[model samples]
Target: MRAVTYDSFAPDNARLRCGEVADPKVGPGQVLIQVRAAAVNPVDWKVMAGGLDGMMDTVFPVIPGWDVAGVVTATGPDTPEFAPGDEVMAYARKDVVQAGTFAEYVAVAAPAVARKPATLDWAQAAGLPLAGLTALRSLDRLAVGPDDVLLVHGAAGGVGSLAVQLGRDRGARVIGTASEGNHAFVRGLGGEPVSYGEGLVQRLRALAPDGVSAVADFVGGQLETTQAVLAEGGRHVSVADPRVEQHGGHWIWVRPDGAELAVLAAAAERGALTVEVARTFPLERTGEAFDASRTGHTRGKLVVTP
Candidate 1:
């Protein structure tokens, strides 16, 4: 099968190339997917640059992606949850770095796969898994509720956009920080928009003078602002900042869960959620897609169609 692969880490992504590689072997409790679309996240590029070497082992010629939407071609024995021909999406992250979604086919553990939302096309479905999981997990950690006023940092980016909507869906009064250009976009997701940096705390205070009841930092570097605007007993969580823990906030790393993926899919189906695709590239152009994600300012998710 054709895949985007890198044999070694390079800061410039110079080693990433598209070429034929062996098709993955389906293991017990796994399903092999014919990938229709894959989303590129910062982790993909970071992994390509060896940023995660301290965390997980990497096999040579590693395929780099976790977000995939595709059709199941086969399921391994004992995997009764899905069958061949099922349309699915998965945050197919594994314990090791290899056999990723940037290929024509990916072998995902059944526990990590969910039926793709019928309301979303391939690219949109592909974009949802990783970002949606991160947003959902952070919100869960913060325990956002109807009585709460919630703030999301970097609210117009992939994870933050979903966090905004999810906060609204959970009945929180959602406030989000974005650039001036993206204020309307965040508002469309049912969040009140505040521009980030310089006077951000004052801006948030203006929006929620009583103080915000919860904060989810999808963008890093907002610990100070989070500390400033949080209600006395409010909760806070960050997917991007490890320093959050020092301030009595939770730090989150998203885990693959098919059940939670199903919830996100159902929300999209109900029109309560949507995934934004800023740009898409073909499989051969996966390196360019990685470059786009590395820009740190793409308005929405970047997808790769294979």
Candidate 2:
């Protein structure tokens, strides 16, 4: 098996070095997936940079990828959810390190894997699991609805794009913050776009005369601005920093749930959800993929295929 790995922590130490390693075999209650595509999330590279070291205990030489889409070549004896040949997608775990989708194959716990939507290609399915689930978890905390006004910061990025669409699907009048360049793109998804910059507060007020019923911050900065703009009792949630809660906002963290993933997959199948792959790199170009992910403000998720 060939995998991208880092044996030590450094700000820019991540690399894709190919080596002959043993293939992963299924374990009890696990599924061995022949990985098709692996999506790059900011979390992946953040971990690579060792930002998460204090928060997690792990050995060096760990393979790091959270959002994975692949096929089940084998399954654990105790698991009943999937069989050989099933197409699946999963968010592995926060603590236990993953062999990861960077490899040609990896073993994932059955509980974490769900059938990929028939409507999505490997790249698309691969792109959505982590970002989409983070968006879903954030919006779930907000509970915006038909009469509500929901604002999404960084609305043109992968999670923001899906959050805007999901808020609309749930009947919220959605407003999203993006630069002028992405206004039309955000509008196409049913979100009213507001320019985000120095005067973002004024821009938002100008567009939503009624007031924002809920604010979801996908962009990690100027959270005080996002918080101040929310309507009275409006929920402010983020997938990023939760300390904003101290300033009268809510923080959201993503956890793996096959049930929620199944819902997302079903929505994608019904044409209610879509994924954007801003870029795709072959396995050997994993370094390039990590570099692309490091570039802040990518329009959508980037992917790597093994």
Candidate 3:
């Protein structure tokens, strides 16, 4: 199978290369997916650069993706949930960081696979799994409700964009932080946009004078601002910063859960959620996709179609 691989940790995705690799073997409770599209996330590049070296063990010549949208080519024994030809999407992060979604085929645990939303094309579906699941978990942890004013940092980015829509769906008034250029984009996602940096605290205060009821920090380094603007009894969570945990906030790490992903798929089908794809790259150009994600300025996801 053809896939993108990195032999060793290198800065700027220096080691990423397209090459042939052995096909994955299906094991019990697993499903083999013929890759249609895979999403490049910041973590992909981070892992490639050895940023997560102390966390997840990595095997050399590693395939580098986690979010996938594809068709099931086969399913392992005991995996009764799906069969060949089933269209699915998954946050296919294995405990080991070797076999991954950036390939012609990938074998994933059945529990991580969810039927793709018909409304989303392959690129969009691929973009949704990791970012959507993260947003869903953050909102659920914060218990965002109709009366809450939800402040989302990095609102136009992958996870933040989804968080805005999900927060609005729950009837919260969502205020998001983004650059001036992305303010309109953030607004289109149902969030009131506030410029980040400089006067962020004042801007958020102007929007919710009493303080925001919840904060979802998709971007790190905003702990001071988050603490300054959060209302008493409010909750906050950060995917980028674990220090949030020390400040009475939760530091969230997304997990693979097909059932939870199915809920997001249903929301997409119902017109209540959408996944934005900034651009699509061919499989061999996955290195370029990683470059785009590393810029930290894309409005949504960067997808690679295999």
Candidate 4:
């Protein structure tokens, strides 16, 4: 099957190579997915750039991707939650560096796989695994309630966009930060929009002088600025930067849980959730996808349909 694999830690080494690699053998508690769409994420670029090189090793010929949306082609032994033909979406585990969603097939643990929502297509579903779960996990940490006021940074990006919708569904008043171009989109997601620029903190303070009840920084560098504007005792968390604790705030890491995905998928089915696909590229254009995601200020999640 065709997959995106890199030989070195250098971003220049990135390429889409065609080769006849043997299909993955599913082990106990795993499911083989014939990937229809795989979402490109900041994490993908981080891996490609060797941010996790110490962990993943500067391993040559590594297929890198996590978010996947596809149909089950085979089920591993003792897997009883799903059948071979079930449509599923998931985030692959960090431990599996070689086996990823960049290919036409990926063998994902059953615990990370969940039925795709009936309301979403393959591309939309593909965009949910990482960013979507991160947003949900942060909200879960804050215990977001209908009456709460929450702030999300990079509101136009994948996680921020989902956080806006999820915050609204949970009955919170959401304030989202983005550039001028995404104001409408942010407001449409039920967030009060704040423009992101050099004076971001000032803009937020002007709009929310009393501060918000919770603060979630999806964009790492913006943590200090956002946390500065948080209301006293507000829940502060981040998916990218673990240093939030140094600021006397909190942090959250998105965990892969089938039960969590089940709840999130059901919410999507009930029209309480949405996944935004900013752009999509053909499998052969994986290089372009990585470039855009790494260099551009993306409006939403990028996807690759192999």
Candidate 5:
């Protein structure tokens, strides 16, 4: 099988190479997917740069990717939930950093695989799992609902964009922070857009004078702004910063759950959620995709097709 591999943690993504590797073997409770598309995430490049060295163990010549949209070629014994020819997607992160989704094929534990939303094309589907899951988890933790003003940092970003829509779906009045260029894009996602950076707290206060009822910080380094704008008895969560925990907010890490993913898929099928894909690259050009992701300015996801 042809796939991307990095022999060591290269901060510049210089070690990424595309070549033949042994096909993955299906084990019990696993399903083999023939890759169609995979999404590039900041975590992919961060992992490549050894950013997560003290956390997950890396087996080098590591394959780099987690979000995948593909078709099942086979299922291992005891995996009665799916069979050959099923279209599926998953956040296919392993306990160790190897055998990932940036390949011609990948084998995932059945419990982490969900049926692909038929309404989405391959690129969009590939972009959904991780970002959607992160957004979902953040909102669930904050318990956003009607009568609350939800403030989303990085509103036009991959996860933040989805969080805006999901918050709106739950009847919250969402206020999103983005650059001046992305304010309209955030508005399209059903959020009232506010520019981040200087005077952010004042701007948020102008929108919600009592301060916001909840804050979801998708972009880190905004703890001060979050604390300043949160109303009394409000809640906050951050996927990027752990210090949020010390401030009485939750620091969330997304988990792989097919059942939860299925709920997102159903929402897409119902037209309540959508994925924005910024660009698509071929399998061999994954390094370029990582470069785009590292820029930290793209409004949506970058996808790679095999």
Candidate 6:
């Protein structure tokens, strides 16, 4: 099988190479997927660079990716949730870091896989799992709802874009932070767009003098901004920075749950959620895909077709 792998952690990502590798093994309660599309995320490159070495063990020649939209080709012993030919999408993080979604085939735990919505194409489906889960988890922590004024930092990026839509779906009046260039894009996602950087707090106060009821920080480095604009008793959560805990806010790390993925898929099918694919690369160009993700300014998700 053709897959991308790195032999060891390094600051440089050019070490990622696409080559022939042995097929992944299907373990108990797992399914083998014939990958159609995979999404590149910041964490993919970070993991490759040893950013997560303290959290998860890595095997040499590590394949690095987690978001996948594919078809089930086989199921392992005791797996009954799916069979051959089922279309699925997953945030397929494994305990070990050997087999991954950046390959022609990946074997993942059945519990992490969910059926892909018929309404979404493979690339869109591939873009949803990890970023959608991050947004959903942060919003869940903040308990955003009607009567709340919710603020989303980095609202034009992958997770932030989804957070804007999800907040609006929950009846919150969402104020999304983006560059001046992306203000219109954020508004299209049902958020009141606010330009990021200097005077952000002042601008937000002008929009809601009473202050925002919740803040979802996808970009981090905004603890001060979150504190300044949050109303009394307001909640806050972040996916990027752990220091949020010091400010009485939650720091979220998304976990793979088939049930949650199914809910997101249903929302996509119902036209309540959407995934944007800003660019795509063939499997052989996985290195370029990672390079694009490292830029950290893409308006939407970057996908790789295998």
TM-score of each: 0.99, 0.96, 0.99, 0.95, 0.99, 0.99
Candidate 2: residue 30 lDDT (0-100): 93
lDDT of 5 by residue, 25-124 (tens): 9999999999999999999999999999999999988999999999999999999999999999999999999999999999999999999999999999
Backbone clashes, each candidate: 0, 0, 0, 1, 0, 0
1-306 in candidate 2: lDDT tens per residue? 887776766677444465656787778999988889999888777877778778887676767688889998998888888999999999876455546667788888787788999999999999888888888988888877788899999999989999998999999989898889888989988999988778888888887766788888887875777766777777787778767888777777788777889889988988888997888988778778888877777888899898
lDDT of 5: 0.95
Clashing pairs in 2: none
User: Candidate 1's C-alpha lDDT?
Assistant: 0.93
CA displacement after TM-score superposition, residue 52 of candidate 4 (Å): 0.8
Using lDDT as the yardstick, the better of models 1 and 3 is: 3
- At residue 76, give the lDDT of candidate 1: 91
Task: For residues 48-98, write the lDDT of model 3, one tens digit per residue.
Answer: 889989998988889999999999999999999999999999999999899
Kindly list the per-residue Cα lDDT of model 1 for residues 1-306, writing each as its tens digit: 999999999997789889899999998999999999999999998888889999999998899999999999999989999999999999999999987999999999999999998899999999999999999999988888899999999899999999999999989999999999998999899999999888888988998999998999987988989999999999999988999999899999999999999999999999999988899999999888888888899887999999
Off by over 4 Å in 3: none
Angstrom error at residue 151, model 2: 0.5
- Please report, as a residue range, the 10-residue window in candidate 4 with the lowest summed lDDT: 11-20
Question: Which residue ranges in model 1 land beyond 4 Å of their true spot?
Answer: none
The local distance difference test score of each candidate is 0.93, 0.83, 0.94, 0.84, 0.95, 0.93
> Candidate 4 lDDT, tens digit per residue, 115-178?
9999999999999888888989999888889878899988899899999999999989999988
Measured by TM-score, how close is model 4 to the native structure?
A: 0.95
